[model samples]
Target: MKVLIKLFATFRNERFKQEEKELPEGTTIRQVVAQLEIAEEALGMVMVNGRHAPLESQLHEGDTLALFPLVGGG
Candidate 1:
């Protein structure tokens, strides 16, 4: 399956801001995160096709996945 991935904030450092990726069928959001080497604790939000999704959510072809890193401020 082919899906579009969007990275936001510090997550984009050393990585692409947006790109289309070829993922195997039955892939889950959590798998993609690991593939990108993104630590679970550092993730702030996960979205699929503009809707919030859980880490175990299954991704389909043409899906758009967006990853955002946790934001911290005083």
Candidate 2:
């Protein structure tokens, strides 16, 4: 299956702002993060197909997943 991943904030520094990824059936949000080398703790919010999603959320073909990293500022 294939899914679209959108990275926000600092997450985009070392990765594409948005990209398509191919994965086997039953891939989860956590797996995608790991595949991209993103620390789990660095993630702030997750959305799948525009709805809030959890780390264990399963990804499906054509799903658009957005990831936001924790933002810090003084």
Candidate 3:
């Protein structure tokens, strides 16, 4: 299956704004992020189709996945 990924903020700096990734059926969000080498601390929030999703959320073909990095402040 093909998944569309969008990286925001720092993540965008590391990865491109939009990317296409291939995965077998039943790939979870966690697995994809790990496969992409995204740091755990860098993962602030996960959004699937514009809604918040957990790491265990199963990915569907042609789904738009967006990941935002954690923004720290004093």
lDDT of each: 0.98, 0.93, 0.90
Q: Which candidate order results from sorting by TM-score in descending order?
A: 1, 2, 3
Query: lDDT tens string, model 1, 1-74?
Result: 99999999998899999999999999999999999999999999999999999999999999999999999999
RMSD after CA superposition, every candidate: 0.4, 0.8, 1.1
Backbone clashes, each candidate = 0, 0, 0
Candidate ranking under lDDT, highest first, comes to 1, 2, 3
- lDDT winner, 1 or 3: 1
TM-score against native, each model = 0.98, 0.94, 0.90
Among all windows of ten consecutive residues in candidate 2, which has the lowest summed lDDT?
A: 6-15
Off by over 4 Å in 1: none
**Model 2 per-residue lDDT tens digits across residues 1-74:** 98999999888996899998888999999999999899999998999999999999899999999999888889
* Candidate 3: tens digits of C-alpha lDDT, residues 1-74: 99999998888765699998888999999998898789877889999999999999999999989999898999
Between prediction 1 and prediction 2, which has the larger lDDT?
1
